[model samples]
Target: MQAVILAGGKGKRLAPYTTILPKPLMPIDDMPILEIVLLQLKKHGFTNIVLAVGHLAGLIQAYCGDGSRWGLNITYSMENEPLGTAGPLSLIDGLEENFLVMNGDLLTNIDYSDLMKLHLEKNALATVSMYNKDVPISLGVLNLDDSGNIIDYIEKPTLTYKVSMGIYILNRKILDHIEKGKYLDFPVLIKQLIEENEKVVGYDFTGYWMDIGRHEDYSKVLEEFNSIRDELL
Candidate 1:
């Protein structure tokens, strides 16, 4: 199978580190995070890979060149301007089949083969990998009525939600929804697909997943990557 990795974000939240290296090039146990992702995809039989790059694209290309070392064929899709996530896919050629698309900075042990299998089984136009996330509120949450009076109050509630894991299996047909040279994110595209009565499925994953887009997440992955290296690699 083919896979497209989005590696072009400016990574403003990662600041200084990203200033020199793209977020995907950031190290996790001496290996660039994107390298780890590539290795995992290779292990899962995804031999054709495309990196959609913009910020610091040269460095990523220089480092990953042809993906020969990883036993994969690598190509690049350059985005002259920042294309919000899914927008870059429109610029990639030869996507005439179902393929995988994921963020370059993600750290996860998700089973890509299984995800693709489910997508094919369901015949979905798009299959998003979903992760269960718990967001903790530090302050008390208040509920108010239209009269501005307090209706209910709760302290430090933990909200649970199913969020996109930034990994997806998309059918070539979905490319019809994308406009060339326009910035389009996954959420907006997914919403449009739903509005048009397209089939979009979600595969729930309760395994390790981290988007190392921020300093805190990057630090956390650095601290824990070693323990889970076997699972990922």
Candidate 2:
């Protein structure tokens, strides 16, 4: 199986650290985040991989060349400038069928093989790995009237939403939805697909999934890794 890693982002939210190194190259435990991702994909029999890199591309290229050390075949798809998540995908070549695609700065125990199986069974053009997120409103949110008067108030409302896990199983045909040489983000791509009457399935993975896009997520990784190292992986 082949995997595409969207590692082009500057990760501005993870600044200071990202200023010196690519977010994917940031050390997580004993190894870089990209290394962890490669290991996980390798474990699941995904030997062919692509690293879509932009900022600090040289560092990543120097670090993981041909992916031979991991017993995987790695290739590089360099973006001249930062291409949005789905945009750089258009630059990749030789993707036969459905393959794994994910953000580089994520740590998760999602059963990728199972996700692929479900994607095939559902015959979907795209399958999104999803996580359930609860964004709580700490203050009472009021529904304002036409004149800006409060009509109702809900206190400490915890809204549960199924959000994207920055991971996906995408069929190659979906590339048709992408405009060439443009910034095409995931949400806009998915929205367009839905509007065009395409099937996009969601593979719910509520298991240990941490998006190390921010400091808190990085902290959680260390905490979770300590207690459930074997299982958390």
- Report model 1's TM-score to 2 decimal places: 0.95
Worst 10 residues of 1 by lDDT: 211-220
The candidate scoring highest on TM-score is 1
Which pairs clash in the backbone of model 2?
none
**Clash totals in order:** 0, 0
Please provide, for model 2 over 82-184, each residue's C-alpha lDDT reduced to its tens digit, 9 standing for 90 to 100: 7799999889989869999999998888888889899999999999998999999899888998999989999989999999999999999998988777889
Q: Evaluate residue 158 in candidate 1 and report its C-alpha lDDT on the 0 to 100 scale.
A: 100
Task: Provide TM-scores for the models.
Answer: 0.95, 0.93
- Model 2 RMSD, rounded to 1 decimal: 2.1
| Candidate 1 structure quality by residue, lDDT tens digits, 1-233 | 99999999999899988899899999898889999999999989899999999999999999999999889999999999998998999899998489999999999999999999999999999999998899999999999999999999999999999999999999999889999989999999999999999999999999999989878888899999889989999
Lowest lDDT sum, 10 consecutive residues, model 2, at 224-233
Error of 2 at 213 (Å): 1.1
